[model samples]
Target: MNQLNYEEISTEFKNYFLNNYRNFIDEQIKEVKNSKFLINVSDYTSETIDEPHRIVTNFLKEKNIKNHRITNLYKTFEFEFDFYLLMLTFDERRKMDIELYEEIWRHNQKL
Candidate 1:
């Protein structure tokens, strides 16, 4: 397998996240709500927000995406959602990231 340069990885990461941002958030919200936890409690509140933030921020760090963008992307959900849903979102995002990386790699090769 060909190794990707830094710029290619960066572009692919940005494209993957920016393109799927809304769907990712929506899926997360759905997952949290579907978990059947009482969302009004303080513990639930902290878990819902903080856990996903940590999971997603860690994912971004692993992917070399800028951490600050997590705040820009994470908004207040009207309904509670599960933190585990972010894991599912991460899986999907990683797949897209791989595709984007390959696409960028192929495009770069043609030049």
Candidate 2:
């Protein structure tokens, strides 16, 4: 199998995720847009959006990933870590973030 296209494969998978979860993501965006206050540092209050859910949709619209074939693509990964990272529920994904960086950090790591 060709390993040269890992990045390309990953990008397609991500787009596929956004496409699949359009409804949930849009609801998140609308919440952010309609909220009068996101955070009040002085009062330590927050109506902050689940930022991980908002990342792609925040700047880019949902993209229909055409010709995407991910069914067997996951087999190419030797570990479940990356696969789960790609498909984890929002809460679990956030937990991984906090555990990884000791803070509410949204970032990606490729293995």
Candidate 3:
């Protein structure tokens, strides 16, 4: 596609993340801390917090990122979610480095 066409899609995703997903993640983060797991924030609900993983996994997949096994359980959904949130945050203003954050995601996933 041309540059303009690409910008349109990019804008759409930008708005999508800003208007919805970002806030959703913020709430999820709190929920994850208070509770052991995430309650579905996005409409595209699945049993687990796979929504974040699915989106993150898809994005990475598109960029040709993959792994044979989930060598680190901590490296999946929670890491992806925090990373994405940081990305959006950076886009807006920037930052999720959080070892504790990763541990939380890893811990919950094991549950």
Candidate 4:
């Protein structure tokens, strides 16, 4: 992508979090103060085959946002090293953050 397109994509990602997931992102920001936190893009099928996730992941890294794209087991294992994980899904209009609290709760019970 060109510089202008990159900027647009970056802006969209920022706006999506600020507008739709502000509260959740705020909580995650607070958690970051006490521990390592990771935001995982759990599904990659929505992105193009040309490594779109890398673009977004690099943008987040520039903003000091810790994140990982869960495309395989190794990546998932690396991401799980963080204390918290926020999974994201792409919908028709925009990306949506999926709360993993219930899944985490259930996993904790198993342990």
lDDT leader: 1
Clashing pairs in 1: 32-81, 32-82, 33-81
Which tens-of-lDDT digit does each residue in 1-111 have in candidate 2?
333354564566466554544544455444434445432232211212344435434323433322223435557645433333355445544443334232112221110
| Candidates ranked by TM-score | 3, 1, 2, 4
- Candidate 4 lDDT: 0.38
lDDT of 4 by residue, 81-102 (tens): 0111222323411332233333
Candidate 2 lDDT (Cα, whole model)? 0.40
Model 3: lDDT equals 0.44
- Per-residue C-alpha lDDT of model 3 across residues 67-92, encoded as one tens digit per residue: 22222456544333336433453434
Quantify all predictions' global Cα lDDT against the true fold: 0.46, 0.40, 0.44, 0.38
Q: Which stretches of candidate 2 lie over 4 Å from their true place?
A: 1-16, 40-77, 81-111
Q: Please name the candidate that would achieve the greatest TM-score relative to the true structure.
A: 3
In candidate 1, what residue range of length 10 has the lowest lDDT sum? 76-85
Residue pairs with clashing backbones, model 4: none
Q: Which residue pairs in candidate 3 collide?
A: 90-94
Cα shift from native, residue 62, model 3 (Å)? 20
Backbone clashes, candidate 1: 3
Sort all candidates by lDDT, best to worst: 1, 3, 2, 4
